[model samples]
Target: MNRLPYATVARCVSSLSRTGLYQGVDLRVLEAFDLDALAHFSGMQPGALCAGACVASQSSPALALTSANLRWCPACMAEGLHAALFQFSPITRCPTHNAPLIQACPHCGKTIPYRLDPAAVATPLACPTCMSPLVADLTILAHAHHIVGP
Candidate 1:
Protein backbone atom coordinates (compact mmCIF):
# COMPACT_ATOMS: atom_id res chain seq x y z
CA MET A 1 0.00 0.00 0.00
CA ASN A 2 2.94 2.32 -0.55
CA ARG A 3 0.87 4.25 -3.03
CA LEU A 4 -1.98 4.55 -0.58
CA PRO A 5 -3.90 7.69 -1.45
CA TYR A 6 -4.03 10.70 0.84
CA ALA A 7 -7.75 11.16 0.15
CA THR A 8 -8.50 7.83 1.74
CA VAL A 9 -6.69 8.80 4.93
CA ALA A 10 -8.51 12.12 4.98
CA ARG A 11 -11.76 10.27 4.61
CA CYS A 12 -11.31 7.22 6.78
CA VAL A 13 -9.35 8.29 9.88
CA SER A 14 -7.49 11.11 11.51
CA SER A 15 -4.23 10.88 13.44
CA LEU A 16 -4.39 13.34 16.31
CA SER A 17 -1.03 14.85 16.96
CA ARG A 18 -2.06 16.92 19.99
CA THR A 19 -3.90 14.22 21.89
CA GLY A 20 -1.80 11.30 20.59
CA LEU A 21 -4.94 9.28 20.15
CA TYR A 22 -6.95 8.83 16.94
CA GLN A 23 -10.35 8.97 15.41
CA GLY A 24 -10.52 5.62 13.70
CA VAL A 25 -12.22 5.11 10.40
CA ASP A 26 -15.96 5.27 10.45
CA LEU A 27 -17.53 2.20 11.98
CA ARG A 28 -19.48 2.15 8.73
CA VAL A 29 -16.32 0.92 7.04
CA LEU A 30 -17.28 -2.47 8.43
CA GLU A 31 -20.78 -2.11 7.08
CA ALA A 32 -19.71 -3.66 3.79
CA PHE A 33 -18.37 -6.56 5.84
CA ASP A 34 -21.85 -6.81 7.37
CA LEU A 35 -21.94 -6.89 11.15
CA ASP A 36 -24.16 -9.92 11.15
CA ALA A 37 -21.86 -11.90 8.87
CA LEU A 38 -18.83 -10.77 10.81
CA ALA A 39 -20.44 -11.85 14.09
CA HIS A 40 -21.27 -15.20 12.56
CA PHE A 41 -17.63 -15.69 11.70
CA SER A 42 -16.59 -14.38 15.11
CA GLY A 43 -18.99 -16.64 16.98
CA MET A 44 -20.90 -13.78 18.48
CA GLN A 45 -24.52 -12.71 18.44
CA PRO A 46 -25.34 -10.46 15.52
CA GLY A 47 -27.68 -8.33 17.58
CA ALA A 48 -24.87 -7.43 19.94
CA LEU A 49 -23.51 -5.22 17.19
CA CYS A 50 -26.85 -4.04 15.88
CA ALA A 51 -27.33 -1.57 18.71
CA GLY A 52 -26.27 1.28 16.43
CA ALA A 53 -22.77 1.53 17.85
CA CYS A 54 -22.00 4.85 16.31
CA VAL A 55 -19.25 7.02 17.69
CA ALA A 56 -20.43 10.07 19.61
CA SER A 57 -20.77 13.18 17.52
CA GLN A 58 -21.91 15.97 19.88
CA SER A 59 -22.18 13.84 23.02
CA SER A 60 -25.95 14.12 23.24
CA PRO A 61 -26.17 10.54 24.44
CA ALA A 62 -24.40 10.08 27.75
CA LEU A 63 -23.41 6.55 26.87
CA ALA A 64 -21.84 6.54 23.46
CA LEU A 65 -22.40 3.26 21.71
CA THR A 66 -18.68 2.96 21.06
CA SER A 67 -15.44 3.89 22.76
CA ALA A 68 -12.26 5.68 21.78
CA ASN A 69 -9.86 3.31 23.46
CA LEU A 70 -8.73 0.27 21.58
CA ARG A 71 -9.84 -2.41 23.96
CA TRP A 72 -8.31 -5.70 22.81
CA CYS A 73 -8.86 -9.40 23.33
CA PRO A 74 -5.96 -11.29 24.81
CA ALA A 75 -6.89 -14.41 22.94
CA CYS A 76 -6.91 -12.68 19.58
CA MET A 77 -3.75 -10.71 20.28
CA ALA A 78 -1.98 -13.86 21.38
CA GLU A 79 -2.55 -15.07 17.84
CA GLY A 80 -1.52 -11.65 16.48
CA LEU A 81 -4.98 -10.67 15.31
CA HIS A 82 -7.22 -7.71 16.09
CA ALA A 83 -10.96 -7.88 15.93
CA ALA A 84 -12.75 -4.61 15.24
CA LEU A 85 -15.71 -5.80 17.30
CA PHE A 86 -13.73 -4.99 20.41
CA GLN A 87 -14.37 -1.30 19.73
CA PHE A 88 -17.97 -1.48 20.83
CA SER A 89 -18.77 -0.61 24.42
CA PRO A 90 -21.32 -3.42 24.48
CA ILE A 91 -18.55 -5.94 23.89
CA THR A 92 -16.97 -6.44 27.28
CA ARG A 93 -15.42 -9.74 26.38
CA CYS A 94 -14.58 -11.81 23.37
CA PRO A 95 -17.62 -14.06 22.94
CA THR A 96 -15.64 -16.72 21.11
CA HIS A 97 -12.82 -16.93 23.68
CA ASN A 98 -14.45 -15.32 26.75
CA ALA A 99 -11.48 -13.04 27.29
CA PRO A 100 -11.94 -9.58 28.74
CA LEU A 101 -11.36 -6.50 26.63
CA ILE A 102 -8.04 -5.10 27.74
CA GLN A 103 -7.39 -1.36 27.63
CA ALA A 104 -3.87 -1.28 29.01
CA CYS A 105 -0.63 -3.19 28.98
CA PRO A 106 -0.88 -5.85 31.68
CA HIS A 107 2.84 -5.73 32.40
CA CYS A 108 3.05 -1.96 32.79
CA GLY A 109 -0.58 -0.88 33.21
CA LYS A 110 0.08 1.84 30.65
CA THR A 111 -2.89 2.70 28.53
CA ILE A 112 -2.18 2.39 24.83
CA PRO A 113 -4.10 4.96 22.89
CA TYR A 114 -6.14 3.69 19.98
CA ARG A 115 -3.77 5.34 17.57
CA LEU A 116 -3.38 4.89 13.83
CA ASP A 117 0.14 6.16 13.35
CA PRO A 118 3.28 4.70 11.84
CA ALA A 119 4.84 3.64 15.16
CA ALA A 120 1.74 1.67 16.00
CA VAL A 121 1.70 0.09 12.56
CA ALA A 122 5.46 -0.58 12.60
CA THR A 123 5.39 -2.34 15.95
CA PRO A 124 1.86 -3.62 15.79
CA LEU A 125 2.04 -5.96 18.75
CA ALA A 126 4.40 -4.27 21.18
CA CYS A 127 3.47 -2.04 24.08
CA PRO A 128 4.92 1.37 23.35
CA THR A 129 5.65 2.23 26.99
CA CYS A 130 7.29 -0.96 28.22
CA MET A 131 8.23 -2.63 24.96
CA SER A 132 6.29 -5.69 26.05
CA PRO A 133 5.37 -8.24 23.44
CA LEU A 134 1.61 -8.27 23.03
CA VAL A 135 1.58 -10.88 20.30
CA ALA A 136 2.95 -14.28 21.18
CA ASP A 137 2.66 -15.63 17.66
CA LEU A 138 3.78 -12.50 15.77
CA THR A 139 2.48 -13.21 12.27
CA ILE A 140 3.23 -11.12 9.18
CA LEU A 141 -0.43 -10.20 8.95
CA ALA A 142 0.08 -8.33 12.21
CA HIS A 143 2.78 -5.95 11.10
CA ALA A 144 2.70 -2.48 9.51
CA HIS A 145 -0.92 -2.03 8.71
CA HIS A 146 -0.05 1.43 7.44
CA ILE A 147 2.56 3.01 5.22
CA VAL A 148 5.73 4.10 7.01
CA GLY A 149 8.19 6.88 6.30
CA PRO A 150 11.54 5.95 4.79
Candidate 2:
Protein backbone atom coordinates (compact mmCIF):
# COMPACT_ATOMS: atom_id res chain seq x y z
CA MET A 1 0.00 0.00 0.00
CA ASN A 2 1.29 3.44 -0.94
CA ARG A 3 1.85 5.85 1.92
CA LEU A 4 -0.27 9.02 1.90
CA PRO A 5 1.62 12.13 0.76
CA TYR A 6 2.81 14.79 3.19
CA ALA A 7 0.48 17.35 1.60
CA THR A 8 -2.56 15.21 2.41
CA VAL A 9 -1.28 14.78 5.96
CA ALA A 10 -0.67 18.52 6.28
CA ARG A 11 -4.14 19.35 4.96
CA CYS A 12 -5.81 16.92 7.39
CA VAL A 13 -3.66 18.18 10.26
CA SER A 14 -4.44 21.79 9.40
CA SER A 15 -8.16 21.11 9.30
CA LEU A 16 -8.09 19.20 12.58
CA SER A 17 -5.85 21.81 14.17
CA ARG A 18 -8.47 24.45 13.49
CA THR A 19 -11.12 22.34 15.23
CA GLY A 20 -9.02 22.24 18.45
CA LEU A 21 -11.09 19.32 19.77
CA TYR A 22 -8.97 16.51 18.36
CA GLN A 23 -5.44 17.33 19.34
CA GLY A 24 -2.75 14.69 18.72
CA VAL A 25 -4.99 12.67 16.44
CA ASP A 26 -3.03 9.87 14.85
CA LEU A 27 -2.38 10.37 11.15
CA ARG A 28 -3.09 6.67 10.50
CA VAL A 29 -6.80 7.40 11.06
CA LEU A 30 -6.74 9.26 7.74
CA GLU A 31 -5.61 6.12 5.90
CA ALA A 32 -8.78 4.31 6.84
CA PHE A 33 -10.96 3.95 3.73
CA ASP A 34 -13.77 6.51 3.69
CA LEU A 35 -16.13 6.16 0.74
CA ASP A 36 -16.93 9.88 0.46
CA ALA A 37 -13.30 10.95 0.71
CA LEU A 38 -12.23 8.24 -1.72
CA ALA A 39 -14.76 9.47 -4.27
CA HIS A 40 -13.63 13.06 -3.92
CA PHE A 41 -9.92 12.17 -4.02
CA SER A 42 -10.26 9.83 -7.03
CA GLY A 43 -12.58 12.19 -8.89
CA MET A 44 -15.03 9.31 -9.45
CA GLN A 45 -18.68 9.41 -8.53
CA PRO A 46 -19.65 7.23 -5.61
CA GLY A 47 -22.44 4.76 -6.28
CA ALA A 48 -24.98 2.72 -4.30
CA LEU A 49 -22.23 1.16 -2.19
CA CYS A 50 -21.68 4.61 -0.69
CA ALA A 51 -25.17 4.51 0.94
CA GLY A 52 -23.99 2.29 3.82
CA ALA A 53 -23.39 5.22 6.16
CA CYS A 54 -26.77 6.68 5.30
CA VAL A 55 -28.56 3.39 5.88
CA ALA A 56 -26.74 2.94 9.18
CA SER A 57 -27.70 6.42 10.30
CA GLN A 58 -31.45 5.97 9.76
CA SER A 59 -33.28 5.45 13.07
CA SER A 60 -35.97 2.89 13.89
CA PRO A 61 -37.99 2.63 17.09
CA ALA A 62 -38.10 -1.17 16.96
CA LEU A 63 -34.41 -1.70 16.38
CA ALA A 64 -31.58 -0.25 18.41
CA LEU A 65 -28.60 -0.51 16.13
CA THR A 66 -25.05 0.58 16.87
CA SER A 67 -21.62 0.11 15.45
CA ALA A 68 -19.23 -2.16 17.31
CA ASN A 69 -15.61 -3.19 17.21
CA LEU A 70 -14.65 -5.49 14.36
CA ARG A 71 -16.30 -8.88 14.40
CA TRP A 72 -15.80 -11.68 11.85
CA CYS A 73 -17.53 -14.69 10.42
CA PRO A 74 -15.01 -17.48 10.85
CA ALA A 75 -16.39 -19.34 7.86
CA CYS A 76 -15.88 -16.21 5.79
CA MET A 77 -12.40 -15.88 7.20
CA ALA A 78 -11.61 -19.47 6.22
CA GLU A 79 -12.68 -18.49 2.71
CA GLY A 80 -10.42 -15.39 2.96
CA LEU A 81 -13.32 -12.93 3.04
CA HIS A 82 -14.70 -10.42 5.50
CA ALA A 83 -18.24 -9.04 5.39
CA ALA A 84 -18.95 -5.45 6.37
CA LEU A 85 -22.28 -6.37 8.02
CA PHE A 86 -20.48 -8.34 10.73
CA GLN A 87 -19.20 -5.04 12.11
CA PHE A 88 -22.70 -4.06 13.21
CA SER A 89 -23.68 -4.91 16.80
CA PRO A 90 -27.20 -6.02 15.88
CA ILE A 91 -25.89 -8.65 13.47
CA THR A 92 -24.96 -11.56 15.68
CA ARG A 93 -24.89 -14.28 13.05
CA CYS A 94 -23.28 -14.68 9.68
CA PRO A 95 -26.03 -14.71 7.05
CA THR A 96 -24.13 -16.97 4.66
CA HIS A 97 -22.96 -19.67 7.10
CA ASN A 98 -25.67 -19.37 9.77
CA ALA A 99 -22.80 -19.25 12.24
CA PRO A 100 -22.38 -16.80 15.09
CA LEU A 101 -19.98 -13.93 14.50
CA ILE A 102 -17.12 -13.84 16.99
CA GLN A 103 -15.86 -10.59 18.51
CA ALA A 104 -13.37 -11.95 21.01
CA CYS A 105 -10.76 -14.64 20.91
CA PRO A 106 -12.19 -17.86 22.35
CA HIS A 107 -8.86 -18.57 24.01
CA CYS A 108 -7.93 -15.18 25.37
CA GLY A 109 -11.41 -13.67 25.61
CA LYS A 110 -10.28 -10.24 24.49
CA THR A 111 -12.25 -8.02 22.19
CA ILE A 112 -10.70 -7.66 18.76
CA PRO A 113 -9.27 -4.29 17.93
CA TYR A 114 -10.78 -2.15 15.20
CA ARG A 115 -7.54 -2.05 13.24
CA LEU A 116 -4.72 -4.55 12.92
CA ASP A 117 -1.15 -3.54 12.28
CA PRO A 118 -0.05 -4.60 8.79
CA ALA A 119 3.39 -5.61 10.01
CA ALA A 120 2.02 -7.77 12.86
CA VAL A 121 1.63 -11.53 12.58
CA ALA A 122 -1.81 -11.19 14.15
CA THR A 123 -4.23 -10.79 11.27
CA PRO A 124 -7.99 -10.22 11.24
CA LEU A 125 -8.31 -13.98 10.67
CA ALA A 126 -6.29 -14.74 13.79
CA CYS A 127 -6.54 -13.78 17.45
CA PRO A 128 -4.19 -10.95 18.41
CA THR A 129 -4.14 -12.13 22.04
CA CYS A 130 -3.44 -15.81 21.48
CA MET A 131 -2.35 -15.87 17.81
CA SER A 132 -4.89 -18.62 17.23
CA PRO A 133 -6.63 -19.00 13.90
CA LEU A 134 -10.28 -17.90 14.06
CA VAL A 135 -12.44 -20.75 12.78
CA ALA A 136 -16.13 -21.60 13.03
CA ASP A 137 -17.22 -24.30 15.42
CA LEU A 138 -20.34 -26.08 14.24
CA THR A 139 -21.23 -27.28 17.75
CA ILE A 140 -21.35 -23.70 18.98
CA LEU A 141 -23.47 -22.75 15.98
CA ALA A 142 -26.06 -25.37 16.88
CA HIS A 143 -26.21 -24.19 20.48
CA ALA A 144 -26.33 -20.54 19.43
CA HIS A 145 -29.31 -20.87 17.10
CA HIS A 146 -31.25 -22.89 19.68
CA ILE A 147 -30.88 -20.11 22.25
CA VAL A 148 -31.17 -17.14 19.86
CA GLY A 149 -33.75 -18.68 17.41
CA PRO A 150 -32.56 -18.55 13.81
TM-scores vs. true structure, each candidate: 0.52, 0.48
Clashes of 1: 0
| Candidate 2 residue runs with Cα over 4 Å from true position | 1-64, 116-124, 135-150
Q: How accurate locally, in lDDT, is each candidate?
A: 0.55, 0.49
What residue pairs clash in candidate 1, if any at all? Answer: none
- Indicate which candidate wins on lDDT: 1
Report the alpha-carbon TM-score of model 1 versus the true structure: 0.52
Candidate 2 achieves a global lDDT of 0.49
Candidate 1 residues lying further than 4 Å off, grouped into runs, are 1-63, 140-150
Give me the candidate number with maximum TM-score.
Answer: 1
How would you encode candidate 1's per-residue C-alpha lDDT over 93-150 as one tens digit per residue?
9988998889888889987765444455545567878878787655433244433343
lDDT of 1 at 129: 81
